[model samples]
Each structure stands twice: as C-alpha cells, then as structure tokens.
Target: MDYSKDKLSSFLEVNYSALPMCCIQKAEVYMLDEPSSYLDVKQRLRAASLIRDMISSTTYVIVVEHDLAVLDYSSDFICCLYGVPGVYGVVTLPSGVREGFNMFLDGFIRTENMRFREDKLSFKVSEQIDEVVKRTGNFKYPSMTKTLYHSNSTMLAGFLKPDEEVEMPATTVSYKPQKISPKYESIVRHMLHEKIPNMYTYPHFKSDVMNPLMIDQLMDRKVQTLSGGELQRVALVLCLGKTASVYLVDEPSTYLVSEQRLHAAKVIKRFIMHAKKTAFVVEHDFIMATYLADRVIVFDGEPSVEATARRLL
Candidate 1:
C-alpha cells in the first residue's frame, strides 16, 4: 500500500507540494487495474518507472492497463483479456511483453493460434501531428500567435521564442471551439451550413463524417435539443467540412463513447489528409489524441492558472 510523493502524484490530480505517504510492511504479488487511466504522459511515465523499479525475482506484478506505451514500459509479461465485462472474459496465457502487445494490437495471438477481435487496432505515431505544425510554417498566421509550449520549452511552429519572432503561414483557416451553441431545429445540418457551407456536398464527408457520426439519424433533431454526443458529432463535421489551409479543433472527443472517440480521430485525420490541409487538435482523451496526432504537444505549468505552452514533442 506504500507509494512515494511522485508516485502518488502520478495517480492523483491534487497538488503534491506537501504530500504524505503511507507504507506497508509486507506484501508480495500486486495488481493494478487501469493504473494509467488518470495520468498525463509525464505522470504516466513516472508511474511506470516506479512500478518497473518495484519488480523483483519473487514479485509478480499484474497491471491491467489500456494505454499501450505505459504497459510496454512497465510490464515484463502481457496477458490479453477480452470478452464483455460483467459477462465473460478470457485471458490469454502469459507471453513476452512485446509479443503480447503485438498480439493485442493485431487482435490475434499467433502462438496460441487464437483470434479475438475482428477489427484490428493499429497505432500511428504523433509525427504527422508535428508535420501539421511544420506545414503551418510555410505561411504566416499572424493572428494565430499563441504557442502551445512544453515544460522543457520547445516551440511547435516557430523556430524561436516570441522575442526571436518566426512567422507562421496559414492563408485560410477554420476553427471549432471547445464550447459550441445550437442555433437551429435541425441543428446538425444547420451547423454544417452556418460553419461549413456546402458540407452536404463536400466530397467524402458523408463517408468520413456523416456515416460515422450518424448525422443522417441526427439531422432531424433541433440543435439545442440534441444530446451531448450528437452535438459533438455535428460540431466535428462542421470543423472538417469547411475548406481551409489549417483546421484548429479543440476537444473533439468530449461527450463521446470510447468507440465514437476512435471513429472521430480517424475521421478527423482522414479528412485533413484528403483535403491536403493541416490541423492542430487540442484533445483531452489520451487514447484519441495519441491515435490522431502526428506530434503531441505537452504543456507544463499550473493546471488552470498560468497554464502556458511548454513544448511540442
């Protein structure tokens, strides 16, 4: 039951300045379910490091985690568990971490000759997200001046600090804010016209946004009367339908289910690439962010106050 300040901080959201710790005298095997659920990237790494250091020849640690990177860094073995929760689940025989992760990602354990999921999960690194930032450097977005910085200090767009003054190029732009307001009865289609004119006629949008978001099912509902998830989908489509050099979408996965979030990320990425446009997305859902981003930005500072851009990694 014992954990250090840094370790506890990784697991908790509260301030850690004068934190306390409680120690356990004796224990052996330990288990953690979704250990990295609440942590940011930095905190997740720290937690993984602490757990990694705790492992011994006699100590067997079983961590039930969803984040691939954190699991890869901490665990020595991998056991893929599938099937519906509160119903039935089957755990694969333990395998090496890499092999297990690969099996989990591939949706088939080759050694066991078993296939679980029909839909495979593939990971895309954040380099494409960085490339979006890099693409923005070709022109100047003088009004889009704020830098999304990191703790150690790296700029995503500009080569230098504000004093150094490197210009960013973005001739055309479209942005979807974190908060949105409803304006019409058929809010979904109405937003499309208001924010992304001709969205219904936008090529591939039906497949990319309309189909995945089930916009057809939602088109009849009033915008203000729509559910959170419905509204989010409409907002996302609005952001993607517009023709622009760069798209800045804030918190696209909010009020969505896990599966919907995944679909949203893929849709966002596909539309951006299809249109040959750049996008900067600010997302809180870690899994969706990792899947959608080409470059992940890390901001370090006070959480709400003085929360400044720190770096792009």
Candidate 2:
C-alpha cells in the first residue's frame, strides 16, 4: 500500500483515504455509499471485513449498498428502502440481516404489511452433475464454504451458491456503455425518430425494442424528464437500432425494475438471435446474463488498470 502509487484508480484512492478516516476518527455516526462499486469480488470481501472490524459499541453505521452479499457480511441490522425511483421512498424498520433481505426479495414487509413490487424474485437452480464429478474426481475436497468474522469476535460461516466497449473491423460496430447521463432536452420521440445516429434508417426499432421495453409510453416525455429506468430503456433502443455487425451492451440491467430487466433481456436476446448478429453484453445480473449469453467471460484483477478476461468453457 503505497497511497501515492499512480497505478491506483480514483475509486481505490478514495477507499484508501476515506476508509481510514471512518476507522480512526471519533465520529458518532459513519456512512458509506456503495463502497464496493468498482471493487472485484475478492477486494469486496476484504473491504467488508475491514468495515466490520471498524465498528464499535458507541458508533452508528448506516451503509447504502445494493450488493446483498457484502451487505450481509458487513451489517448487523438491515433497513430496506423501497419505492418508485425519483418518487417517494419508504424505509422499513431495521430488522435482522437475513429477514430484511428476505423481505426485500419477496417484495413485501410482513410486519408493516406492505408490498412494493408486483413480483418476487427467485433464483433458478441448475446442477451440472458431469462437470461437478469431473472437477471432483479425486478424494480431495475443495473449499466450498465461506466464513465471516471480526478481529476479536466469533466467526459466522455459510455455504453459498452463485461492461465494455470498442470498435473496429470489416463490419461496423456499435456500443452502448453502462452509464448514460441524460443531458438532452428533446422528447423521446424526437430522440428516437431523429436524434440518435441512423435513427431514420433503423428498421422496426420501435416494434423490436421500444414497445417491448415500454418506451412508447414515454415518447412524449422529454429525455431530461425521464427517470433513470426510462432513460435506460431509451438507451437500449438507441443501441439496438443502429445497423452494425456487432453490438456491445454494457450493464443493460442498470436502473431497471425486475420485470423490465427480464423484458429487456428477452428483447436483446431475441433481436440478436433473429437477426443472426453478434452481440457482447456486459451485465451484472445473474439471470439476465444467463438468459442472454451463450458463453460467459469472467474478468479478474483491477477494473481499469490491469484487468483480464477469460471465457468460461
């Protein structure tokens, strides 16, 4: 840890500087927002451990995070915030971590008798018996368990389960990066019909992507007035509308509700398959990725510094 190292990204530098303050300063309360944003899986676990170790009997920590595993590891109690984005939000009373997560996933709070979402999200279980046997032919067992602990406290253990861009080549390529800051003042219809590149020539884009993602409903709304989820859907249509041999979709699940995400995944998957075109999707959602991808590539190391990707076989 050389804090002055030029190779460190802004995210890493911020973590290095801010985490020490949270640990050392005598503050009555500490707050962290998405501290695990750019960190890889291994680094996230280490950061969670550090946060857990820094807690004391006198201090209060309120963390705004989306990663369930990290939140589970780092929190004693969990408070779920639910509501329409850019609209009113309600926070539930603090409950045990497991219970809070269950309530969040189930889309209903039992004690308060409230339902935020229309559908519950459930994981699809898949077993690879041949792959499992092939990987574990020998008598030796692999590390299949995870342990969470504090420096001076008893350990808790559990058994668990489990973006990009660029150009080039013979055929043209189009990219939709993970984030889009809505700076436009034009309406969605204008943006769709004339604003985006090749919008006029994009055949059946509205039928293929827009209507499915429900972008037609927002056609009259200004781009700047659209919510995050609405903007994301518009972006997807823009990306898919372009005439190119290959399409790069980064984090298509961002800011989208569960139902919208599933629909987006379906639209993208169908478009690619039907058109017989090539698409590289960078997604964080398990169900979204599995549904859309034929083969998966795993990335390792730092995000922007010295990253590497290997395709799963």
- Candidate 2 regions off by >4 Å? 1-24, 125-169, 179-185, 195-233, 253-276, 284-293, 302-304
Query: What is residue 242's positional error in candidate 2, in angstroms?
Result: 2.6
Question: What are the TM-scores, per candidate, against the unseen true structure?
Answer: 0.54, 0.66
RMSD, candidate 2, Å: 11.0
TM-score (C-alpha, index-matched) for candidate 2: 0.66
CA deviation > 4 Å runs, candidate 1:
1-170
lDDT of 2 by residue, 1-313 (tens): 5656565544445554566666677787888876655444566687789888878898788887665667889999998887755558788999998998899889899998888878886644334534222233223111212211110011101112211222113456666765578877888888777746565345576577767787757888999988767888888888888877878776776667555777798889878877778787766555566666665556654433344444343
Distance from true position, residue 62, model 2, in Å? 1.4
Angstrom error of the Cα, residue 275, model 2: value is 4.6
